[model samples]
Target: MNLKDKAKLLPQSPGIYIMRDSLNNIIYVGKSKNLRKRVYSYFIKSNNVTSKVEKLMKNIKDFQYICTDTELEALLLECTFIKYIKPQYNRLMKNYERYVYIQIDIEDQYPIIKLSSEIIEDNSLYYGPFINYNRIFKFLEGLNEILPLIKCNNYLKEKITCINYAMGKCEGPCIKNVSSKEYKKHINKVINFFHGEKDLIKELEKFMKEYSETLEFEKAKIFKDYIDVFNSVFKEYKHILRLNNYNKFIIIDYIKNSIFKVIFINNHNIEYVDTINMNNMDKKDLEEYFKNIYFKFYLINNKESKNIVTKEFIDYVHIIFSY
Candidate 1:
């Protein structure tokens, strides 16, 4: 059958598609709802494909697809296939290195601490691909203020002698002052914060209330300070909700040595921000990986991207600390 015949057979439902070259090399992997419509749209002579697409089309000889239940399911399938095929025409998620993320080993007694330019299937949590190293560090410092979890293996020595320990700042893991249970609690808090918990402010409020009842003013102050930091990160929410609101999500990206990316949900959606430092990962490297990872980043969010006009985060940090 001709391309048109194959196209006519594509389902109107969501699914992942693959474009292969004469050599049977997969050049592109994508997902679409209404596969017939999306594939046909690509074949339009005037569609103005990207330079990469044009080259891909020149070598294209055949294609295949797997239908899915929903657009989101197609998205998941697209990501999976792109990783497996590492196609030339697809932009892979974490395929690029403009932003580097911090990876932690979830399986070890103490996981190895390191930086990553690639996404792993391991159960470990990936923190960022920050374009600004300084901002990433600043954010990590803020995180440390809320959670007393040790970030790295500064406890290799039998004696707890890290700088933070020496300075009487950290309750050393080496010293066992921080019990496993307490450490686990801090881990959960950090994870919840990063994963966009809508109840974050509420959780803090509850913790503060309990701390006050126990007369643990110092501990309560920590919660208050975090709330202050949280507020600084977001401009005053017109309406703070006890839950996530996902009408539309917008991006406010601050680019420097890392990308300090913020996800702002409008029309009552929750606002979540995350930063990753790709300072160590060069653009040339990420460019090579873009086909695999970059495409996972939905550019629809870019439609809403604009220069950051507010220094509210910086201003809030200053005002809250002045007290």
Candidate 2:
């Protein structure tokens, strides 16, 4: 049978479909609650199909699927397959290690703002899996100017003050001009700022106004740049902050055909996944089941491994978090 005829034989169930070229190499992996509908859609021609999809479809010589109990399982399985297979058609979240973040080394006696490419298990605070490096870099640069936190990498080694300290832009922690306690207070403000509790933008605007009123055009321009970066990035940053807050929680989702899925999350990693059939249990039994699983997993505090953000895991997180 041809690929189109073969797709028609697929079951209408939650599963992932693997598409292959004539060379019998798996080129793409996709999932759907209804395997037949999704697989069939790819075979049928449409003018609205994207160039990428058109190219992918043209190369498809055959396909197959792995049946899953729930859509969540299908999603997770798709992430795993794509990560291991490294299919050419699968693009997004593939290079997750390249994702950027704003790191605050809170473990240090004097914390400083720095950009990081990955998240690790440490005492430091991380602010993103931000995609745009230039934008985040600009925002961090502006933030360093607005906040009197440390700026130099040599702050721990050098006993003397730097250019930023001389210009009153740094608290001079390296020279003992600011105590760790006082400097950390500034770090707390930055933490609150990312959590959407503090208004750093308002302060930047205030400084901009003051410089403008005093006719210090050069200084005013600097503050204006900071305010502009904040305005552009803060909204998305707030959304990211909320997404990151999906730590240590349980997600119960009802799948079709009387199936319910329970996901145990800890520090953005899925600790466990289980499914129960509503048809098999009564109300009291369901309640007892939930209670058992809840107490079994919820009360315990588990530390995420240092290398928590795997490519597959990141895609899985995005799928469930968005759901």
Candidate 3:
């Protein structure tokens, strides 16, 4: 069948569409809330196609699509496929190294927080590979006030008072002033802040108000910037924490004929994700299968699990499951 014929067959639902060239190579991948409309739009003769899309269309001989349960699922699936497939037309996400993560090495005698572009496989905690460096820096600075962790990298001498300590910024772990237990408590606070336990926004608001009252306009502005950044970043963290009441939970999404089960297990610093395929199964059978699989996995792993489901994932599940 022709491309137009195949486009007509696409379901009017959310999905990830794969466009392949004559040689059966995937050239482009895209997600849409309405697969039929999105795919059919490309076939419209009157539609203006950009140079890139024009080229993409010229090579396109066949296409396939995976019907997702919701638009968010389609988006996530599109990203996953693009990362793995490395389609020629997709350029933005090809270089994943550009992403940055905030790393906190709590294992160190004097733990220091810093930014890392690479994902390090270590015991240290990493927050994100976020695009907003300015916001991350401001947020980290605000966190420093609450946690008072060491900011320096070099090892501290026994008697020398570092500049940070002199400024009352650090807890002076190098001088052994703060006991390891006490330092650990500070680290826990920082970890908790990241996990949405402590309210950085409230702290920023308090600081901002204090500075404003004292007529420290510059300082108040800085605090205001931090507040803005925290508001944006914390929204996602808040969503994750909402499901923290559940030690372990399963989110099942029935997409077209396939059932996608996302099993989330939350441990100390890592969130483990396992996907189960329960295609063409009844709800009762699916639940039984999930229990069997979850028990065996839990017994083998023996780790604490929590419901850290992403807002997008949960929101999409609600949309698809509602139908």
Candidate 4:
């Protein structure tokens, strides 16, 4: 069938639409709440569409859709296909290599907080797959200022001291002024802060207020920017941690009166999608289905590590986390 003819066959439901070129190679993958309306829009010529979308339409020779019970299911499936297929026009979430993480090598005598694009097997702790490199860099800069952690690279080097030490800003690990055991306390506080235990926001706010009262406007503004960056990034950091704690969970999305969309997530992976027609099933049958899912998936595939966010699935998790 022709492209327009195929589009007319799509149902009025939430789903992912795959656009293909004349060569039958997938070029674009997109999700929408209404498949028929969304797909049909492509055929209905509109000048308002972006140059990118117009370009995408020019290459499209065929299209297919996977019908979903709910928009959420469509979103999950769309991410799966985009990640695996790496479609030509699917731009977002494709550049996982550019995602930056705040790294801390606790294995070092004096660990330095640094931004890393790649996660290795080295025993360091990695905190993010954050997209904003400049924001993270600023947040870490302000964080090191408040925490008295080493901000200099001269640590364990032959250099006696740096300006940070002269101003009593760092604990002075380079000069052995603070032993590894003592300096670790600061790192532990940072770890606690990342874990959502330490209330650094309040403390930073206090410093901001103090600087403002003393007429140190520049310093106050500096702390203000720190707080801004912290607020933007830390919430997502905590969210990833919470999500990684779940090895398996079921998201039951109510589509209508008697239809439900069931998504089974295991180990940051969407394992299965099941649609249920509750028009015939009784309460007891519904309860049994949930119980079976809980026991079969949740109990058997419990999360092993609460803190570890694997670098491999960080981008995948980002897609779900954003949704």
Please give each candidate's TM-score.
0.40, 0.72, 0.63, 0.86
> For model 2, what is the error of residue 87's alpha carbon versus the real structure, in angstroms, after optimal superposition?
1.5
Point to the candidate with the largest lDDT: 4
Question: What does the lDDT read for residue 263 in candidate 2?
Answer: 78
lDDT of 2 by residue, 1-323 (tens): 98888889999989999998989999999989999999999878788999999999889988889998778778878888887888889886466666687889888887888888777778888876665578888888877777897777788899888888878898788879888998888888888877776488888989899999999999999989888878767765654545455456777778778888887877666678888888999999988987887777765544553433433355566676677
lDDT of 3 by residue, 270-304 (tens): 13434455665679987897677677655665665
lDDT of 2 at 52: 95
- The clash tally of candidate 1 reads 27
What lDDT does model 4 reach?
A: 0.82
Model 4: how far residue 302 lies from native, Å: 5.2
| Model 3, residue pairs in steric clash | 100-129, 247-305
As a TM-score, model 2 comes out at 0.72
Reference-based lDDT, residue 145, model 4: 73
Query: Model 1: residues >4 Å from true position, as ranges?
Result: 1-16, 45-48, 64-86, 92-142, 156-160, 166-169, 173-323
Expressed as tens digits, the lDDT of each residue in 1-323 for candidate 1 is 87867888888877888888888888888777689998877677866678877787777799998886545446645655665567877764424334455566655444433556666767776654434444444445555554454655557566645677666556677777766566565556655655565455666677788899999999998777766655443322212211123234434445344654444433322233344456755888656544333344433333342222122122222222221
Candidate 1: what lDDT?
Answer: 0.56
Off by over 4 Å in 4: 1-6, 44-47, 216-218, 300-307, 318-323
Alpha-carbon runs more than 4 Å astray in model 3 = 1-13, 21-25, 43-62, 67-76, 91-102, 116-123, 126-134, 145-147, 157-167, 171-185, 238-323
* Ranked candidates (TM-score, high to low): 4, 2, 3, 1
